[model samples]
Target: MAEQKERDRQEDDRSSPLIDQYTARNPEQFARNLARAMEELGKVAAAWTQAREKGEASDVSAAPIADMIKTFSRVSEYWLGDPTRALEAQTRLFAEFMGIWANAIRRMSEAGIPDHAEAPASDKRFQDPEWGRNAFFSFLKQAYLVTSRWALDLVEGADGLDLATRHKARFYMEQVSQALSPSNFLLTNPELFRETMASNGENLVRGMRMLAEDISAGRGDIKLRQSDASQFKVGENIAATPGKVIARNRLVEVLQYAPATENVLKRPLLIVPPWINKFYILDLNPKRSFIRWAVEQGHTVFVISWVNPDERHGTLDWSDYFEEGIRFALNAVEKATGEKQVNAVGYCVGGTLLAASLALMAAEGDERIATATFLTTQVDFTYAGDLKVFVDEEQIAALDKVMQGKGYLDANRMATAFNMLRAGDLIWPYVVNNYLRGKAPLPFDLLYWNSDSTRLAAANHSYYLRNCYLENNLSHGRAVLGGKKIDLGAITIPIFNLAAREDHIAPAKSVFLGSSFFSGPVEFVLAGSGHIAGVVNPPVSNKYQFWTGAKPAGELESWITNAQETGGSWWPYWQTWIEKQDGERVAARKPGGKKKPLGDAPGDYVRIRS
Candidate 1:
């Protein structure tokens, strides 16, 4: 035992030298860097103040902080109102802490003891080797995990709260826990501490400067930079697919890509992407460009580039989107290709619009669209994911008033909400990297496209929230559009519905549930990964797998249990499905058949950053 103690002392001595190698060696330099960081922080504060004066920062009244507090109070009432229950909750937490303390003590007495509490393997925040190797960090990590789980369990076990209130409480709790993570702070995070010590606090100086610049860019708010924005441009490298704008309208520009094959399908493909984001997500680059691949697969593709709406478009509602957006594109495709019937594709909210438009077409005896494809789209919001937390009547009313004042919801507002959905992945990591660790994120095309947000018009956004999310009208055959009641059963067109297994924006279960609403035979395919990667997966990458099985009948889990997994990208599978619908071919047509070309593909509207 004495020899073992000597060996342990030697190990500690060896580690001390190694740690000293990264410690601040020059006090003068460290002082200078600290002073510079302070100056940068001052600038950050000033920029925020200036933004507030200019009304560029977030409006306090418009924020949901109050709503969060109100919901949390209800949770508090559940726990605190009952002495026994409060004691039980406290006792449970105390017991967990005691267990963790016992484990820590055991770890000290015996070197090989495992952690009492461990983060999931997939959690990147706790991936640093020091988090496990260092006793202090390990204990801190376990304590945090235990507390966070306990807080969440309290919300789950709480009574007297409606589903909406409970959901809000849970989401709010997650956000708070994520924000307060030890990994977010330099002192608690071993990696950040080491980085700061090694660089003599220079990292913090750089980080503060970047923070000030980002705040200024956000007009007094911190517009977190998720990627190196300098490395990407719209037409230059990112959305550089060869195509031309064959038609233009107030709401959309119909971009028809140049043919990449000798022969093309008879029916031109029209894609109605969500107006909440640019159409370039489908055409990020040639490597990941779904549009380019489809064009190469002997199909003429036309995509709608929605205008970044300002106050001028505030009054535009779903009808305008249907008529001027979808209907206009269908008319343009007919003029461009001389084909009245075309295959249609819609992504996310775009799919929702397409589903409604198809119903309207059925009612009007218009059969322009031959088939429909929905990508991570939700027609039924019954099982919609975390996004539902934001859609109660009270919140919607408040949002409506805010939109009325500004004519549209700001891009940052929408971006923030989306970021909050995965705050652990999206928000906190960026906060630590950009502000705490003082590092710029690597250039990523997907993140770049994600950062390029679009504004939501008041009337249109309000109608969508109230109808789709709040009321779930589209699925119930109660949705009234353009003074006509929409019936999903009336539209019997063949439908290809795709859902990502790990998609948060649109859950797989929700998509499966939605598939049942369509009267037509729906070919439901489940792809691996989240909303973006799952849909944009190309054949060459050979990354994730996709699953196919019996029609989307019964529960999602049951269907998945009976499903067959296909390796590689779902792109080829989708191509085969497309061909199954219509295999007739014709000579490949140029950008514009009859209509004149306005400009290059990825049109002018997409270039307009909000």
Candidate 2:
């Protein structure tokens, strides 16, 4: 027993060096933060002393100080309240996990393997040889699954935590648990362990080098083995939908797709993709391109490709986006098609901006938009899912500091935040493949587009989160744009609202809630997939399904309860809706007429990297 203890101590001592290598930089950062806090406190103390000496009244605002204490108390309660109960829960879960492993070991000793579904169907990591068939590996997977659940439940089911506080707690806890999963480490992951033996540790060496490169590039937290940006080129393999740039501005480039059908709808369609990402998401490939699909549906399609902003465009605001971005594209589409009215579609943040523009336009007595369609958008952000965990004033202030320093929100930083929302699906699996197994990343079009992120100008991004996300002013009729309070209920056009059931960024309930604020007749559709997939689903794929009803209720859950399920994509339904709103078909307008083509589809603006 003494010798075992000695061996364990030796092993722990050896592990310390490896742990220190990863954690050495954290101490300095912590120290810097502590020093800054102390400095600020000192300044406050000095000011208070001066005020007291000058016969001025009390210290800095007691109300704000009291509020700060209350906030800290709430945070502390979340972390440290009911210590005994938390400890008991942890102990019970640990025992349960140990018992599971013991049973597995006993079954293994009898030369038998246990068949158990330890993970959800969505988690593909455990499908590896380590967890599927082998007895010992199956035990590890079960133990891991048990422990992960315990850790998550400990935070989620904790007492004295409000709904919002518990959600935030669980989100961070899940991230930590996922990052520390057995599948993400070389020794613990059986497949990687075998591979390491086969390659004589060469893979580990390669993985170490990869880790070094990532750390040097400051992307260590980006666990996914993202696609090589070099493999993709705009207007070539991806975003290859044949089209011509009809108009260009400092903020956007409007591309008009070549007609695929003989006769096209007289009313043109204008699509506004979120500037947070490049526009190619809607035009990824010919097989799945929404632009091509719309054109093939006998509709003249025009999309705005937003310029990837930089320090040069730091001062651009929402007003600029309305004036020079969507509104500008609207004018161009009208001029190019000679159609005074057009049907408009907005996806994600683009939807938010489009709704703002429509409200402002309606206020100004502009009736250019005939029909409005929103795809996975949240104009009313009251219940905007897990992303809102960081929407509090303190977090926003911290984000403000970051944006102020960089002039624009860094693409990597924003990507990291989004990835955190779905870490188990997107992050840990790649951590295992890229770092633990030392494998190269494959070429995936969706991931390539995900990695191909665009910067958000400081002013624009800050205003967006502050007003729409934080203030919820857009739906409340107090959202100001171009010095006017834009009211959502003012725009009474036919509306098609599509919300994804599994969207983490924009919750379906919030999207549904936003629909209630619109005075127009709304066709609220809920699709079965996530944000991107839900929007890009094509009828030809015959993949996921959607739910729709005659009239949606005020509550989302009730609407879903009464909604009817339909197989295949929502694109066909959207097409039918568009056709009904559109006028009689005419000879399809060519890509360009009097004016020359500015450039090819997925134009110069998309080529710019942040």
TM-score of each: 0.95, 0.84
**Candidate 2 segments whose C-alpha is farther than 4 A from its true place:** 1-87, 101-105, 108-117, 129-142, 212-224, 228-230
Clashes of each: 0, 0
Residue 313, model 2, lDDT = 80
Per-residue CA lDDT of candidate 2, range 1-610, in tens? 9869855654443344433322323455545544554454454445445545653322222333344445445655654667886577768787877778677666666655454436876677676644655556677777778777876776665567788777676666676678777788766666565555444455555555555444334332232447765677778989998899999988899999989899989888899989987988988888898888888888888999999888778888999999999889988987788888999999999999999999999889889999999999999988988777667676677677766765787676677678878888777766666655566677888898997888889889988989977888888888889999889998899999999999999888889888887888998999998998988998889999999996767677888888899999999988888777766888999776567888888789998865
Instruction: Write out the backbone clash pairs for model 1.
Output: none
Residue pairs with colliding backbones in model 2 are: none
Local accuracy by lDDT, each model: 0.89, 0.77
Give the per-residue lDDT of model 1 (tens digit) for 1-610: 9869855644454367655734686878999999999999999999999998986665633447778888889999999998999999999999999998898888777987888989999999898777787878888998999999999999999987888888889998999999989999988987787768767899899999999998888777677899999999999899999999998888889999999999999988999999987898999999999999999999899999999999989999999999899999988888888898999999999999999999999999999999999999999999888888888777888888778887888887788888888898888999999997888999999999999999899999999998899999999999988899999988899999999999989999999999998888999999999988899998989999999999898899999999999998988887888889888999999888866799987789998887
TM-score attained by model 2: 0.84
Which stretch of 10 consecutive residues in model 2 shows the poorest summed lDDT? 55-64
Error of 2 at 82 (Å): 4.5
Error of 1 at 314 (Å): 1.2
